[model samples]
Target chain A: MVRSKFFVSLISSLGIIALSVAWMPVPDAAAADPNTFNRLMKPPSKRNPPPTQDGIHDPGSIGTQGLQTPREAFKPLPPAQSGNYVDWVKAFDAKKIQPRFDSKDPKAKPVIMDLTIVRQVKGSMPDVIFPHKQHTEWLDCSNCHPVPFVPQKGANQMSMASIMLGESCGVCHGKVAFPVADCRRCHTETKGKATKTSAKAAAKPAKSKKK
Target chain B: MQATIHITKLRLLPVAMLLLVGSAAVRAEFGDIVLNNVSEQQGMRPVIFQHWFHRIRFQCRVCHNELKFEMRVGATQVTMDQISQGRFCGACHNGEIAWTVENCDLCHTGKPGLTTKIQGGHETKGPGIW
Candidate 1:
C-alpha cells in the first residue's frame, strides 16, 4: 500500500510540474523590451519598414496590403538615415517626387521665398543658416509664422534643448525632416567666413526679416 | 520535493509579470495618433492616424492650417459625418487626393477601447527621444 501511495504522489507531482512549465510565458520576439522601449532606439535595420510591417498601420487591414511599401517607393530616391529615410530635399531636387503644394488646389503654387536667417550661436558651433528657399519650396509662411516663429528678428529664443524637446524647428526637424543628428547641415557658417548663402543673406538689407 | 516545486513556480511569477508589462508598451510608434472620442461608443475601432506618412507628402500647413486639424490631440472633434461631408480628412480622402472614407479599416485601425490621445506622448513636450 505504501509503495502504491508513493507512486501516485510522484505521478501527480510530475503532472503538476509539466502543467506549470507549459503555463510559463514564452518570450515573444516581437514584444517590446521594457528596458529599450523608446522609439529612438529602434534598430537601424527596422527603419523605414513597409507600411504593413510598420507598427503605424494595421498589418491585417486590406488597405495596408494594397499600399506600396516605402522601400518600393524610395527605391530610386536618395536615401538618408532618419525620418522617412529618403532625402526629401534631394529627392525633390532630383525630380524623383513632386508632392502637391496644395492638397485641394492642384494648380496652387508654393510662395517660394529666397531668404536666409543666420542665428549666431554662443559657442564654437557655427551659425545656423535657416534657408527660406528650401523650406518655402515645401511649406507655407503660415506654417511657422505668427505662431512658433513671431516673424520678427530677435524674437524667437531657440536652444538645442528646446529643439530636441520638439519645439520651434523641432516641430518638423526631428520628426518628419532630417533629424538633428546632422549637426553640420544647419551649422554650416563659420566665424568671419560666411558661406555663399549666408553672404547673400547679409547683402540683402534686413527688409524681408519679418518673413 | 513539493516545496521545491512551489518555490520554482513562485520564481516564474515575476518573469511572467515582466513579459506582460513589456507587451503593453509595444502599441504605439513615434508619431502615431490614437483618436477614440466616438469610436468605442459607435462600436468601431479607434482611428490610428499616421502623421509621419502624411507629412512625408504634404507640409504641416496642408492639414494644420487648411484642413483645420488642431495641433493638440483630441482638440479636433472629427466625426464620420464631418468626414463624409468633405471636412477634415474628407478634404483629401474624397476618393481623389487620397483614399476615400469607404476604406474604414485604413484609418480606424486602433485597438478597441483606446482613448483619444497622441501615442509616443505629446510631440512638442515629450522627452526628446530622437
Candidate 2:
C-alpha cells in the first residue's frame, strides 16, 4: 500500500513537471505550434542565422533606416544638383572624347554620329529628344542600331510602358547609363509641341483589319 | 481527375508559351553566353560564358578579332583535347593566365559535381581519353 502511494506521487510529479515544461518558454513547441506558443521564445541564433559570405546582409539589422529613408535626403553629385538646365550636357560636351581602337581594322576611324530624334508620345509627356552624339561618343553604334531600335523611323513603336518594362531605350538607360528619373534631362523643351496624331492614325488601319 | 488534369494542362500552356517567347527574344546582355554542343550528351551542364568579366579587362576585338571566337553560338568547335593543347578557350585558360579546366564550375555554372575541382571523376593525364 505504501509502494503504490509512492508510485502515484512519482507519476503526479512527472505530470506536473511536463505541464510546467509545456507552460514554460519551449522554442521547439513554438516552431511546431506557432499559433499557440509565442514566436519570441525562438532562440536568437536560430531566428537570425549568421549571414553567409555570398548572401546579402539584412539592411534593417545593419543600422540603415528600414524602407522609410527618402532617396532625395542623400546629397546628389555636383552635376546632378546643379541649378543650370544644361549643366550635365555642357559638362559632357566639355570633356575630351577618346578615340576607340579597333583591333581588327587598325585604320578604322571612329565615326561620330550627331543626330537628334524627336519622338512625340501624345499628352502623357513632352516630346523625347534623343541625342545620338552623346550616346555614340561612349558606346558603339551596333550596341542599339540593328536590334532594339531599328535605324528606320516609324519601324518600332516606342512607348513609355515598353521603356519601363526594360525594352528599347531601357536596355541601356536606367541600367548602366543614367536613369530615366531626371525629367528635364530628356524632355528639355517645356514648350507645347504640335501634334502629328500618327499613333491613332496608324492604329486605325490595324483596327479596321481586325474588324 | 480528368477535368483537373485538363485544367492543369490549360494553365500550363500559357506558361510554356511565355517561356518559349522569352527564350526566342534573347538579346545579347553583357555577361550572357550559352554554349551547348557536346556538354548535354556528355552528362554536363552547358558553359555560360561571362562576356562582361572578360570585356572589362580586354576589348571586344581581342576575342572576336584575335582569338577568332565566332559571333554565333556553336560556330566554333572547341573540344577538350584541343583545349588542353592550347586552342580556343585554352589560349588563356591553359593554367598560365586564367583558371584551367580542372576548375570546371567557373564555366559550368551550377552542376552536380561543383564541390570537386576536376570533372568526370577521373583526371586525364593526356587528351587520349577524348
Candidate 3:
C-alpha cells in the first residue's frame, strides 16, 4: 500500500514540474537574434518603447507636418478649420514667420520663395507639389541644397523605394522630423487642369530653369 | 525515500519562481538605441548603440554627462566626420581606448532589416550584439 502511495505522489510531482516549466514566461523573439545581443545585458531607456496614445503619435502633434502613423496618428489630430493647403500657406505668410536659424546673422536673409512645382509620376498616386516656404521655416537652405538635391530643377531622382530606405526626403520625413504616410499633404493640387499644366511643363524638352 | 522526494519537489517550486522573477527583471533592464542622423541619407547604415555593452565597464555619467550625449535620440547630431575627429564617440574610439572607426561594420550595420530578424515588441536585432 505504501509503494502505491509513493508511486502516485511521484507522478503528481513530475506533472507539477511540467506545468511550472510551461508556465514560465517566454523570452522575446528578438532575444534569439545573435548579432544584436553582443553583450549579455543592456542599458535602460535605450529601446524605443511602443507608441502610446499620448506619445509622439498624439493628434495634437500632427498638423501640416507629416503624420507619424496612418492609423493612430490621424485620429488624435485636431479637426482642420481649412481644407486648402494654399490657405494654410497664406496664413503662415501673413504671420511673416521668418526662417529660423541656429546662429543669428543679420546678413543671412531667409530665402522666402512662393513657388509650388508639381511632380507627376505617370499612373502613380496623385502628383506631389514641392513646397519651399513651408520647409524654410524650420531648416536652413544648406540642409537640402546641392547635396541630396542639386540646385538645378529636376536634378534629384525621387522614388517611393528611395524614401522608404531613408534616402532623399526620407532622411527627415520618416525619422525625427515627420513621416511620409499622409499622401495628401504633398499632393494638394485638387484640380485636373493644374495637373495637366504641370505635367506639360515638366515634359517640355531642355527648358531647364537654372537656380 | 518518500520524504526525500517530497522535500525535493517542495524545493523545486521556489527555484522555478525565482527563475521567473529573474528573467522578468533582466528583460526589462536592457534597452537599445538607434542612431540615425545623416547615415541613411549618405548611403550608410545607421549605428545601433547598445547601452549594456558600455554600461558593464562605465557608468551612466561617463556617456551622458562627460561625453555630452543628449538623453533624447537624434538630438545629438553624431556625424561620421565628427566621430572621426574624436568628438562624441570618437573620444573613446580613437583606436587607443576602444576600436577605431576603421572597423565600420561593427557598429554601422546599415539598415536593421539587413542585419537580424527583428521580432515584435519594437525590439530590433542588428550587429554588435556580442
Q: Please tell me which predicted candidate would have the highest DockQ against the true structure.
A: 1
Each model: TM-score of chain B?
0.76, 0.63, 0.62
Model 1 C-alpha lDDT per residue in residues A1-211, reported as the tens digit of each score = 5455555556665665565556444545756565646545556565556655444455666766776665666678887765566677777767676666788776777788987777878778977777888888877787778878999888999899888777788876755567688787778666555544554655353324323
Native contacts conserved, per model: 0.29, 0.01, 0.00
Residue-wise lDDT of candidate 3 within B4-112, one digit each (tens)? 6765666566567655643342221123345665666667655555442353334333555456765445567788788898888887888877779887766664232
For all predicted structures, in order, the TM-scores are 0.71, 0.37, 0.36
Winning model by lDDT? 1
Interface RMSD of each: 7.0, 19.7, 16.5
How far does residue A146 in candidate 3 sit from its true spot (Å)?
Answer: 1.4
How would you encode candidate 2's per-residue C-alpha lDDT over A1-211 as one tens digit per residue? 5455555555655565555455333445346765764454423232211221101212223211221211222112123421111123333345322222343353465456866666665655656666675665445666566767799988988765666555676554443334456565665433343244443343343234323
- DockQ, per model, reads 0.35, 0.04, 0.05
Q: Which regions of candidate 3 fall more than 4 Å away from where they truly are?
A: A1-100, A104-109, A198-211, B1-130
**Clashes in candidate 3: how many?**
12
- The global C-alpha lDDT for each of the candidates, from Candidate 1 onward, is 0.68, 0.45, 0.47
lDDT (Cα, tens digit) per residue for candidate 3, span A1-211: 6566656766766676676566554656776877775455432222323222212121222221231222232232332221110122333345422222312232454456645566665544656667665666444455567656787877878887777665677654433333355566665454454555754453232123210
Please tell me which model should have the higher DockQ, number 1 or number 3: 1
When 2 and 3 are scored with TM-score, the better candidate is 2
How many residue pairs clash in each candidate at the backbone level?
A: 0, 0, 12
Q: Which ten residues in a row have the lowest lDDT in candidate 3 chain A?
A: A79-88
Q: B40 in model 3: Cα distance from truth in Å?
A: 23
Question: What's the true lDDT of residue A17 in model 1?
Answer: 57
